[model samples]
Target: MFEEHGPPIEFTAAGDTPEEQTTNLKIVRPSPGFDPASELCAEAIIKDADVTVLDFSPQQVTVRFQIDGLWHAGTPMDREMGDYMLATLKQLAGVDYRERRERQTGNFASLYLKKKQKFKLVSQGIQTGERVALYLDYKRPPLDKPEDLGMRASMGKQLRAIVNDTNMGILMSTAVPGEGYTAVWRGMLEATDRLTRDFFVMEHVGKNEPEVINVYPVEYDSAKGENPMTPMKQLMLKEPDVLAFPDIASGKLLDQIVSHSVTHEMPIFTRIPGKHCLDGLLRLVALKPDVKKLTDRMTAVISMRLIRLLCEDCKIGFQPHPQMIHQLGLPQGRVAELFKPMVYQPGMVDENDVEIEPCSNCSGIGYRGRTGLFELLMFNDELRQALVSNPRLDQLSAVAKRHGHVSMQMEGVVMIAGGRTSVEELQRVLKS
Candidate 1:
């Protein structure tokens, strides 16, 4: 049985310092006859790390934890302990524990720190031994209200107007995986007046099933003779005022969706994977090959990426570097200070006269939460006409910019200037 505790345990990275590494090693190592796997899993949950990967080798087992979208190394274990941990996880996930040479996947729930947490476990055999990945389903607070989604006031107004527009069109949410595109789309759905308009969704799996929206589940199984498009067709027959699907990938499905949007005069909300708004729209055109139909019906494309926000309690303010100011195109003397995730204060010494430690508020991570950086491209008459004729991404992007479409890079720059995040953090996400 899992024990519910007061709060989650905070685990320091093994590579932080030699003394800290030794301390963490002792903490992670299992006691005699006790299961180390369970202890480690519990510790990870308590620490708020949502993902764990364990690699088994002849010599030892390596553990890594994913925190805030980055992976950090954890303490290692001996082969015996590693085997025990793998077997324990397999059993808990209800997979084939005895068959170690095949791939398997399963899900299980546990009570950790007084919360019911779910985990998906996957195991695969390798030449060395086996590799196992455990993905925790960390529940996030609802951002149902559009105001809570961190959009600028002006942008929020525009988005609301677009959503409430009576004309039927296709609205797209675009971002790379893990970029909070789904959350943004869900929030948009919530912004709709559910009491009046009928909203429906089709998805392979569902999360956070809102009461107002009707969701139809779809599964793709060739062996079981399941057609993925059947559920989609069924959902279309209902003729919802607003229809949503998780993604637009298959060419055939994309064509059908476009056709429905045209014939039924209903707005369809879907997502596509892209780094930019124009890139996503271009991909959609490639999928359907009906540029005029898509460009005419498409209303807007919202591109977003989640960036870590600096902890207010411990962030330190500093003057901008000369080059950074120039790179951001800011008037050099006007902007005074920018903030960085600072953990320590001056003259804060330890018993040995060293710096005491990082800020307790952020656990020395320098960031507490994340906020979205959005770039919205709302199509206008000019953009639609340009797309129909040229179908060139560069030309379309120019028109979008002329029509007040902000790029993701510019959004990050604005955030950095406002001291909500640091330039280094922005660079980390943008890789520029």
Candidate 2:
């Protein structure tokens, strides 16, 4: 006889009763002149002990928090229906939240309770306008979080071997209000475990911590004869509109908010999956002045966008017309006339599909999601000189073209010829 087999074991659910999972938390009720959710959202002051509960009339309660620089209110919640929230906040922030009572006109009235603590988990440091607070609604996976926020001073030293050892320094990103720029820069510093603020700036000259300094106004002193371009004076004086943040200088300010996340190491996500991080790194590399050796050594950054191919299912083969070949400037029949002419509808095909069929992948649109297209251009002495001259983007493009480098638009054209994207689509985004 065969032995009876047992079913696979499943995870044990946490709580046994609904009531055990729910809790009542006291929240600071808003006055008539103030917004209720604002207290929990961006720019709101939240102590570790902050909690939310319902009013006596039985209306559902809601809370808001700043997440990635955006303010959002949570789902409507009933009183005593979110014990998990109460417990989670206590564990994460290390504070107990409860309620208090006061005598009103006749009987006792309940209100949010507040108790002072002798200590806090996070140390109180000198506050700066450079710091931004990013809030999260629901916790995201730690592995997918961004970790870099600010630039490190040591990076200039570390890259010495890759560039001119002397006359090389970092340039920081200017603060853009409400973009979470400060928070991103600070978060990056925290990732490297070198987070600090308001120490003597000169003392940390060779260290990793980045300095936050005010941008000095553009000044030309007639009596002193101080030129703003003087290297020594420039180092000592930043433009008034260009507040220098160390984290942004080192390019760490754009790192992901989540610790140890592999995917979200950059602040933004583009449609192209891996292109976001690669683009950011490329931009940082471009910003450096003395890193000519580094720039020359690297190949182009990789980016991908899906494209559509001619639909073989309904395509009809025919010789390409002379006009089409002439416009393309290919010698007559020099380009192999393999797949001639195809159309989506036999009689009603639009001029857009002069020689291609509607694609099954694109459901007769001749395209799908997006095709991956790549453009690689290496920089050298010529390009660096162009950047140093502070030429407009057009001037730089012209110089790059003279060096036999293919423009980003040309790469897109190659993709277009292959039916990956229409010329019209390329026109919409092909920045000069």
Candidate 3:
């Protein structure tokens, strides 16, 4: 084998080895002293973090973990070791590490604790240095049902009523990306009367979820230029009762769906992305479908956003001033005690002269997990008329308020007052 005065095929190895490689494929040997756990992660960290970040700089790599939408710092790492770790991880994730100036994404899977963990790795260059971020797909528990998604009891009833309707209309579930849009959308699909009614779902081939009981899940080869509509065209030959699919990105498809639902009296369920219920609704309306037809054919929009739950053990309940309550748009005398998180002040010591430890439950972050706040915007005659008369958001919102569509803001206040979450967390989520 010829030694190189040039690059030796860029073979990667762990940073603990200071000696450089002399030939291509020379770093393949793993002996008794090699331990990958130190480079990638520990068993406990794999269970704790929903997202992990390794931000590199000239001097060091700052490690951070995101739990329930909040970032928690991990121990700092040495720069040389961090760079080696990053390069090895990038190669394992199938991303190019040479071009660190450009953004790259790759997928990696690992089996830890007998469960398959899928990670989406994103690495990019920055002005000062480079950074790598990873998201844990399996960290989120399954939102298998309406209650699991944290829907209020009353809102759940209203949604079930919409799903059980015999009349033809469009029922949409909207949430921003990564905000449980799939849960709401698929929950709507699963809530249907699939036993008696022929319910079907269309997704790209091989991307369909596990088959639900009594519901037909179909797929099309998008690589072959066949989509959900392609199979639906042939399926229409049968007496298909209802249809469900994802992605409303295509205007032609939206128009076809609206026209088909109205003309054939078939109900359809789908999802879209936005900040809240009205936000998602208006985005669809902005697509410029027939106002009258959409108003007539659309049944309801169930939209939602997430709110972090305070740690039960560490949350401090305090009396809220009436002025503070009113400032938060809360009704007078409605809330007596409100909860807030306890911040660890530096140099605070216990009776034994030992530094006070942060809350064990939330790791001192004061919030453990998150739950959803939902807005069910049902289109009754008044709301439908309101849409036809004034599709403008303000005019429609005024009418929606009169018809008992509780906005997520109001719902969040309820959650805050109930001690389920804190005012700070509520503000952060709503502002987001």
Candidate 4:
């Protein structure tokens, strides 16, 4: 897949330039006549952060950025400038500028760094003032294959086989929001032969529409008393060979879709929110209340999470720690290589009494990009029989393990052993 699609594009800050690092820095503010709010927005984009939050209060406003799954404090502003910033963003999003006391939501698009970017803005009234959240939809490179999604080669091959199966079944791909679920679904769609088969997708937000795949936008109309299932019914009439629902649906509509997938021998792909494969499956069965039917038509359940990949330019190699090795159940006397981000503390001095500098490659962040940790549960006859009777999550997990299933934790350990990531990173991501 990497050979066919080339390498994944590396994400970079908008105004980032290759230059020498210097201790002297300057803070450049906008001119008196220029808009400070617009400048701040542009700066956020240049930082390449996914989400930004503005906490408004009568005294002042607090800013924060969500970068690499962690939040960092940003520059704060006075009350006057904060109010102006909120008003400017509301105007840009097409929300009612006069109605700041009520909750409102809107979206806008603009060209940033020569790329068209979209953002979702949401605001709600608070005790002291209004709180605003901004979500940036940065454009990502095309994920043309399963391996490109950070899946192990063997797991990717298994997933491809399930996707290509002729028999009718249900394959549930589970992940939290903003954790690469959509990208994985799109890659699975790309693997199918679209020319010979009909493909359809149902989603509320339409983004990154793949070629040769039909998309049906689902929206609700309160004034007209419209039903949300109308669109699903319309798409079902098309007799699609493969149907995908990016979000979980409820009520009789879900039953109809599941029934169709089984009765017509069509493979259906759906997303559920859960941390593990069995948990996702149990949730789906609870919604539909047809355990037999669901288990009978289930082909596989895949659960995944994203972890930061170690920066190759400056990652430091070390021998595995005794505690880490014992936790991973590695055999004693077997040498293993591990890598971690080199951390620098304050007030460190060299032999010449000069302060030490951070690594330029990772900017002291230790990691530069992200990869995925996946757990796949394929339903064989034994597993299906076990699930037919209601079982607890631990029991089901034990059954899967008995069948030689590799979990996300195990996958993370393997990546650590291979020097793809660090133990600290794995613990941070998997932390409750």
Candidate 5:
């Protein structure tokens, strides 16, 4: 009720008389059937009018708004306010959330909302020219901190990696007609990238093709040593004439590969354990120019794997193991902890009177994001010569390990112990 008017606005039956009261509440637009979906989102209720625009055209209207709601502590969505609206539109539009908005700092968020929903303003069908005043509070929500943008960008990259690296193919979560094979090659086209030679960054699988054998099936060779497929070679290498589809003796696929290598310049760097089209392509590449350099490059490619890092938003503190502290050379009185799960008793409270617990970003796993773990096997001239002479892969690995080599498992363990990741994550990624 306004001081001057001194009476509340009233609501009545659709076609009847009205009764009024002296309360502040009023029916601003009783069942008027105005759809904010077409002009703006429900979130427009709490956003800045200037930043949040409602665009109208002859065909459709667009709603653009910002998220300014505070979130619960320790959840990934805690700082992500507009997530609900974006997720809702994603479902209605039948599109992956990735397609909705531009990439924000490491996060994929729709900073400016652009959602469209259609509806009739009234049962009698009011025309577009009719003037309708929407009653609004005319208040604006506060802006988010700039750091939120960084968190978003980081999260987006990891999510993009997960979405792009699914079984279907890189960048392809679905197999739709008219969309080219989404699973492009894993190897990088850039010659300067450290992982340019890795399979995922390069070789793409062709659409509608049968599975070829794995090209690097044998355990990765870190040191040059004795050949592993000699016995099978003796059996299959008898008929050397066939190029594409030669008659292979039973139990002699390696011989066929060897024969193919010898006759057609096929590069069988290492036998891949599984069946995939990349195996055939490896053979094809072996015949190409500079095949040796390419074959040698596989060793470098297998040496690295990537892991995500923990989110700092909920990182806590606690005293680490003495051995770990000593190894890391951390100061005394320093400890490691995370946002505790709900099941346990509360720990000592910090200055803010909040309980210290395991971090929520990593779900108490101590990691929320990932980084690359490289285990290089830098073979010298002697090792290459040893490979030419044909030594076992285990023997090669042994020498590499003795000569300052690091295994992928060791890398994961180191990160876990250092609080960069969790033991569970290390196991999940390394099978340790």
Candidate 6:
């Protein structure tokens, strides 16, 4: 996967066969006066969009823009114009435009908004046609601190408590695909008070990992049928105080880690792919097959999701109805007005025969930046005992409430009530 990759690329419409999806999609050839550079710039849209996609199906070619972790469809083009556009993008990125059979990835730099930005181009041949995806690496700001990444103040305190604790336990961070798992986990590791403790990171042979000060990395080549347990035995001679397994995912090896290393006052930090923290815990159990080994030493499991922020310059406010608030499960009489994006109309002109201009700040997209929604499932004595007995979603949800744990949706409602985001946007990101 590419660095800061966008969401998954869809070749056809959801729940529709390929033949059915292209029934209404028509490609009108002979695009009049199509200039490759101008067309590429137009599809790239404003400063809000980070990545632009040009996907060619048999029937037509579709353009997509990545905004706030979601993909929005752009203007469609005919096959002839699409071919020219693809070649233009490849030539600009220094990739061979003529070689269409194999996969290719390259980068190109451009001047936009008085900034020199670099873009990555990836072109892969499909069964029907070619699909090219571009990424603007700089658009994604560096989120080193939890507060800057939309983490709640109280939650940040809780995470710091766990990170600074002298006890031995397990710390894990969970997120779905393309939901900033690597960034969140790295931020957690950075938050650690690792100066006094000897921290060692067990990672795969080849991975683009960030270099954290005072933390050393030991590699294991999985391509050669290697595992992390063998390297752990070798590294144990130095007597590491904290072990961070960023990419060692074998359950059997993890069982060895917890059984041998945990009681010696060495805490382990790991990551897993899941929809939420509880989901991650369940997945860990499934991987290890021994619930007691994980529950006894669990410290906390944190999860996160990304949501778009409304542009203050162009966001429109309107009174909310009672039903709308009730449907979103917001507290009654709490929210007065809601915010939404201002879409550009086809003929939005003024009465003075002058065209109405969209907002220049946001380029009429009505959104400028994004913030993350976070949730934490911190373990305590009662919660761990309960999990050991019954490890199920419904049971854990009921028990977690008694422990004063806040869920991701409940945390998102604070943003909706503050008018920083809208109900529709929250629902869209959660459901997506």
List RMSD in Å for every model shown. 8.0, 18.7, 7.7, 9.1, 18.9, 9.5
Give the Cα error of residue 163 in candidate 5, in Å.
28
Greater TM-score among 3 and 6 belongs to 6
The digit string of per-residue lDDT tens for model 5 on 125-151 reads: 135411111222332232122112122
Query: Among these predicted structures, which one has the highest TM-score?
Result: 6
TM-score of 5: 0.33
Where model 3 places Cα greater than 4 Å from the true spot, the runs are 1-47, 80-130, 134-141, 205-213, 220-228, 329-331, 350-354
Per lDDT, the best of the predicted structures is: 6
Q: What is the lDDT of residue 79 in candidate 2?
A: 39
The global C-alpha lDDT for each of the candidates, from Candidate 1 onward, is 0.72, 0.31, 0.73, 0.70, 0.31, 0.74
Candidate 4 clash figure, as a count: 0
Q: What TM-score does model 6 achieve against the real structure?
A: 0.83
Q: TM-score of model 1 relative to the true fold?
A: 0.75
TM-score of each: 0.75, 0.30, 0.79, 0.73, 0.33, 0.83
Q: Give the Cα error of residue 41 in candidate 2, in Å.
A: 35
Which segments of model 1 are wrong by more than 4 Å? 1-39, 78-124, 202-239, 245-260, 331-334, 342-352, 358-361, 389-393
Worst 10 residues of 3 by lDDT: 1-10
Give the Cα-based TM-score of candidate 4 against the true structure: 0.73
lDDT of 4: 0.70
- Cα lDDT of model 6 by residue, 137-238, tens digit: 665567777787888888888888888787849888888767778778877887888788889988788875877777898888888888766687788899
Clash number for candidate 1: 1
lDDT (Cα, tens digit) per residue for candidate 4, span 308-392: 8888877899888788798985665574677988755557677999997756555456676687788888887777777777457
Across 1-432, the per-residue lDDT of candidate 2 in tens digits comes to 012321121111122343322221122221211122222221222212122222221344344433222233434545343333332222223233231122111111111223111211111112221111222223222321112221223432332222221111221222222333333333222222112211111111233433333212233333464322223234334211111223223313222111111221211111111222234334554545234433332223222222233344443344557775566544677644423223244345457855544353322333222222333344456766665565456666777788876554666555445544454555544421
lDDT value for model 1: 0.72
